[model samples]
Target: MPLEFVHSPTQQTFDIGSRLTRLLTLLFSLVIVFNTIFAFSVLVNLKSLDTCMFLSSDCSWSAHIDYIKDKAWSRVNILRSLKFTLDRLTLETINMTFIRPLLEYGDIIFDNCTAGEKQELDKIQHEAARIVTGATKLVSIDKLYSDLNWQPLSDRRTNHKLIFMFKIKSNISPTYLVNLIPLRPADPRYNLRNSSDIPLIHCRSTLYYNSLVPSAIRAWNTLDSSFKSADSIQSFKRLISNTPKVPHYFNTGPRRLQVHHTRLRLDCSLLNYDLYRKNIISLQACLCGDSESVRHFMLFCPLYTSYREDMFESINLLVPGTAITLDLLLKGNVRFTDPFNSQLFSIVYSYIDSTKRFI
Candidate 1:
């Protein structure tokens, strides 16, 4: 028996490995030869599809997201293979170039997904970052994102959706999509606060509640009026791109150098102060009979005086006349210029090496 189905004039379906048991139609006489069902709302999402985009009996993307996850993890395997040869910058470039596009493709399907499904996607990114930077699974995922300046997938999805919403708002989207966005009309004589937003209608189903346009609108309405009022799409993107709160410094150095720097920044060192706080040591004091903290380890310790003096002199040469504050050198928290030069890092790394703080 052949599968019978109705086709929308605009949509063209591919053999996506979906099985159709039966089709409901008044005309049961209309017979069609096909094996798979249409991926409702996720058609032709991006050019050159890699995995089969399937639609189960229910119109859901939970299974589709799993296909995407499998593809993404395959790329992460490649990234892991090249880890020894590639630095953080190169690995991140590879991920953005190859893996990211796949994860972001057909983002509309994500609208109907549950929070747990979205978390599966987020975990892929977290693992990718860990593999690239050689960070162990024991490392805090948040710390890895912060140190590497990587945005979580959920935020990235929201950003992408808002960009599409911007296109619709700016009248740059296709007529079909623009018409589909549920917007309420405003009065000419009076002003209303919700005029620029999509109406919060009662959704009888959770699917309707979390669907594409409504969720996008909810995110859209949260933005400042100035952001939405951009004259051009590029301008709008610029405004929203900066919505993610960036850390003080975005590390671009190699992973070999970065792992130690990350450990120092996170205060995961074996300092007696840290040890004492963890109840591993009785007192937070140095062998020189002074407090053993990062400040003491870097600047004031009597033991590493020669190495510390060398580090100070080298850092002075690199950043002439600027005050060497604790945060500045340790975390590279510069307001204007990045003072974490290669020479300065070498000096600091060398100083720590001599003190054996890391070992």
Candidate 2:
């Protein structure tokens, strides 16, 4: 029985392997055709649009700046037209509440702006400040910013980026951006140098890399220790929002008075002398035929002698026998040592107000 069972050495079998391969090829061809049709449809729809609706995943400062300018200028123009009807404070409020928000709607877009672009955007803010405060053409931009409690657009953008990073770091929200930023190492050796140390990223495109992660990390590392040590993301935001904008030296007194003092110090007053200087109106000279300058009004003008004497006495009380020099008055270089520089500002404000009627 065993010898009777025999099998052929060369036996033909079903070609299942070739059949399966043909099936896979047909499926792949259909998939490719479907994808091609879908892509064509997308391109056709995109071409039909008047303007491109999608933002590039990569940051484009030029596009963002143009868009922001368009949004901001519309509001700014309205404010400018109403300059006669609106006071400085009201104008500033409108800018802060309405115009500024428009400018800052997608502030993360500014994180990658070149220095030149940043300066250009900052100029827009400077222009807004000038318009809001009615500052003359001659007023210093820095002084205007100080007066308005506004940070440069560059600084604001950095703040916004870091705040976003903080939110990601604190797990306040789950975002793909968190994966781009590496967590600090637990090793003491790694963290010994800077409390806010961040690991370096190696990539061919530094700008793109910075746009995604390094910029935020760099900004966060430079933050004050208090900011770094915040207990929660919300607390961190609250602290940042309430933080003093200007340096302690310039942040003296009530905000309103600070604004007034800034105007006076920057020669933005509506005195006839300043008006004539700005060519807003014609005036030959002071009544005494002296060249009408801030120095002349604050110090040498005969009309303000009484007020000058009172101001000097008040100033001397702070720093005994401190003389108010032209340099001191206009440049804020006081000889006296008030930590906040409040006394010098107060004396200057008083002197300017006192001379207003005389002018």
Candidate 3:
């Protein structure tokens, strides 16, 4: 009987090599799996974050149906869910979290919040307060994101109510888009604040201008409550309430009316009289002298005496009588009595020149 005892170093080396290969292969596979997961996550975050919910399933952060069915405000926790969802929103998810909600419930978000579910109403107020308080520190986008991130999540009621709010916000005016930033918090521009312009949940007052009573009534009541004389209060209220409404006449109105009247007259008379037909004479009649009528403007008006004489002397024409009649001047066909023409001519020319400058 014989026993084999010889061992080769080469055999040992081969065995170790096989084990190492297996270990290396397993490690590489694990790395590949990790890498695939990482890549998928990055892609999902980048691609879907900016987009809003495509379906009800996409917003399945809660069992909303159950919460709604119960009609239990405490259990709803809509605001808290919204806060959580808001945290999930990134620059990538801006449209989904902020813009989409704005487009949907913008009116409620900006104004008219009475229709909002209680939870959502609370969230809106919470958000508004946070925005106002943090405004000074929120100069940049990153800071804004961070501040919002720390805000407490809204409750279930806020979440369910937000659906309607988003729906209403969608109809806001383009000007209100500025409200996305905290530029003018109290200015009330762009429907961001309540206004009497529309009948909405917050501004549906039955009194004049949405008041419970007339302003005069309110004032009188206040005075009467203080023990003022009844007759005095009544008289004061009547006097204030019956104050006459004064018409405000803008300067432009009267000026335009006069200009229109003159333009029409001049345009109409142009054919009958050649001299008067020209805008120069017509404008002079409308503008120069104490007698504002067109007839006084062209012929006998004293205001233009010095001006007319100067023109006449410059052109080497005999100074026509100040008393020259309009009809005589028109028929005379006196072609350029003065080389510089009449004062009326210069006035009209100047008027046209000024008018053209603005245009």
Report, for every candidate in turn, its global Cα lDDT versus the true structure: 0.70, 0.66, 0.34
- Per-residue lDDT tens digits for candidate 3, residues 81-100, read 33322322222243234322
Tens-digit lDDT track of model 1 for 231-341:
998888878776454332434454555556655565555677866766777999999999887778877989888888888888787777868877766666445454455
Summing lDDT over every window of 10 consecutive residues in candidate 1, give the lowest-scoring window: 33-42
Order the candidate numbers by lDDT, best to worst: 1, 2, 3
| Error of model 2, residue 166, in angstroms | 1.4
Count clashes in each candidate, considering only residues at least 3 apart in sequence or on different chains.
Answer: 0, 0, 27
- Clashing residue pairs in candidate 2 (N, C-alpha, C atoms within 3 angstroms): none
**RMSD of candidates 1 onward, in order:** 20.5, 29.4, 33.1
Candidate 1 Cα lDDT to native: 0.70
* Clash total of candidate 3: 27
Better of 1 and 3 by TM-score: 1
The TM-score, computed over Cα atoms with residue i paired to residue i, of candidate 1 is 0.71
lDDT of 3: 0.34
Q: Give a tens-digit lDDT track for model 2, residues 1-359.
A: 46784445433233565678899999999999997896565344323212222265665567766776666676667667655455566567667866777666666755566777666667667777877665667687777776667777766777788788788767775777678777776655643648457766665775766574767777777778878779987788777767454334444444444445555567775555777777787883777788666667777889788889998788777776656677666445534455626667777667766666523
Q: Which stretches of candidate 3 lie over 4 Å from their true place?
A: 1-7, 34-149, 153-359
